[model samples]
Target chain A: MKFSILVSEGPYTHQASDSAYQFAKAVLAKGHEIFRIFFYHDGVNNATRLTTPPQDDRNIVSRWSKLAEEHKLDMVVCVAAAQRRGIVDEGEAKRNGKDATNLAPGFRISGLGQLVEAGIQSDRLVTFGD
Target chain B: MTIKKFMFVNRKAPYGTVYALESLEVVLIAAAFEQDVSLAFLDDGVYQLKKGHSTKGIEMKAFEKTYGALEDYDVTKLYVDEESLAARGLTADDLCIPVETMSRAALGKMIEEQDVVLSF
Candidate 1:
């Protein structure tokens, strides 16, 4: 079965992101296809390439990026949500005369329409929120 | 014409934050577009579905009552997660508006059936 997961919480402050990540991995391990992972609200922070935790600490953004890259998964962070939370990418930052957007590669900045499209296409839609 | 069904997922608490009310407004506004809209209250969102919520203390109108008026807007689909209601010790009878209750698995399947799903 193909499933779309919606992560609507940030990593450090909320369990929603971690739990969703774990669940997504488990879903893949179970041999199911992941239609997509749609990040919105605070979950947009997961796409920040600038996010750095202690070297020993778990870097969830990197974890998500690696997972997407390794599995060739489609991970999308909501563009409006990302911008609202000060997470513009290189083009956006350049256009706005800021430093850079710096969102990770495997994770693209899109919009809620992607979520809607995922909803329409996927066999299942799961959400994790805090 | 495909009356694209939309499930309005409300996941925030009702007090102080704009998400709860803003989510409601979104559902109402979408109903104007004649979309098939449903509401699902999960997590702290179940608080928004409780009965006798008078926003008068905050000098805001009691939009809680407006849940019933969803039928007026052709947004009759209403659902609440049973685990959320159970965690809060609430039953469907305790709410002012009528709603179909389901398990998380069922909710997952239902959300996939919609043409659109918006969360706030």
Candidate 2:
């Protein structure tokens, strides 16, 4: 099986992100392929590398980064949502002359049309929402 | 793109918001175009499947009854997540319509088999 996941919920506050992570791990273990991971709405929070959890708690941004590094996954954060939440990549931050870039290497900023394309291209489109 | 199967994962409460209703209207119109349409309710969305719901004092139109009309639209693949139901203290018997309830794993499998999946 192959899939593209749609995430509409943020980390820490909702189970949707956790569910998506679980599903991704299960799919990969099952020998399935993931075409891309589309983050929308609050889900873009998953791509914000600046987030800092308590010292003992798990950092979702790091988790996603590690997963992408191992699997070469496309962690896509929606441009509109990222901007609305103030999550900018290096390019965006540099272009806008922002002080810093909060997005990780495994993640890329994209548009909703990519979501429509993901639905069109993938064998499966699973959505994780709150 | 030509969509063969269309699935709408309803995450919002049926009332007090326009997202769910607007989404339903979109799916209905899609079904009219001869697309395969299905609805899966999760989280607070389980409240959307309950029966005997009426909105009078709230001055909002009752959309619960519209579930019946879905069949007429050929939008018959109704599903509810088992955990979502238990957490909400709801059951299929409490619903006005019959639904195929399954675990998240099964639901994920179903979603993977669809051509397009939308959540609201």
Candidate 3:
């Protein structure tokens, strides 16, 4: 089955992002195709490269990037939500006249249309949030 | 692929968090896909449909009016849990839009029938 995952919370602040990450990994491990992982609300925060964790702790942002790299996952952060939370990509930063961009590797910023497309194209659409 | 039934289960109130508003945004966008879509309001989520909501003092955009746009989007399956409304001293009359009220059992059955369930 093709699965699309939506994450709506930030890393560390809640268990939502971790649960979503685990669910995505489990789905892929089962040989299911991941249509996309659409991040919204505080979930967009998960795509920021600025996140820094303790040396012993797991780096959630890098973990997602690595997973996307290995599987070629289409990880999208909602542009509207990302802008509101300051998770800007290079293009968005240039367009908005910002000095910096923090979008992590392997994740692209897009509109909510991608989320709707994920739901329409995938067999299952699962959301993890508060 | 066949058309799948999608249910968006909203169990939270508005303004207090970003979930309610963001959920609505997804719903609006999903409408364009022409799927079998429904909105279920239970727990404090029932408050999202309450009429006369004013964001004047709160300094937030009053999105209560946006619910009215659901009709224009061709997404009209709005289900309000009767128990949730009664618990909050509200009725279908208190809401801005016309909605179908269902018992908890009926709501549960409806949820089970859906191909996909999203909660926010």
User: Model 1: per-residue lDDT, tens digit, B57-113?
Assistant: 798666777787888887877888999999989998998888899998898898888
Q: Score the docking of each candidate (DockQ).
A: 0.17, 0.18, 0.67
TM-score of 3: 0.96
Docking quality of model 2: it rates as incorrect
lDDT, residue A109, candidate 1 = 80
> Which candidate number would show the highest TM-score if scored against the true structure?
3
Order by DockQ, highest first? 3, 2, 1
Q: What is the number of backbone collisions in each predicted candidate, taken in the order shown? A: 3, 0, 0
Model 2 Cα shift for residue B115 (angstroms)? 2.7
Scored against the true structure, residue A19 in model 2 reaches a CA lDDT of 91
Model 2, B1-120: lDDT tens digits are 466777888887888765576567657766766667788888888888889778898898888878888988878899899899999888889888989999989998998887787978
Tell me the tens digit of each residue's lDDT in model 2 across A62-95. 9989998999998888786777788898788987
Cα lDDT tens digits for candidate 3, A64-103: 9999999999999999899889999889999999999999
TM-score of each: 0.67, 0.60, 0.96
| DockQ, model 3, C-alpha based | 0.67
Which residue window of length 10 is worst by lDDT in model 2 chain A?
A111-120
Displacement of the residue B49 alpha carbon in candidate 1, Å: 9.0
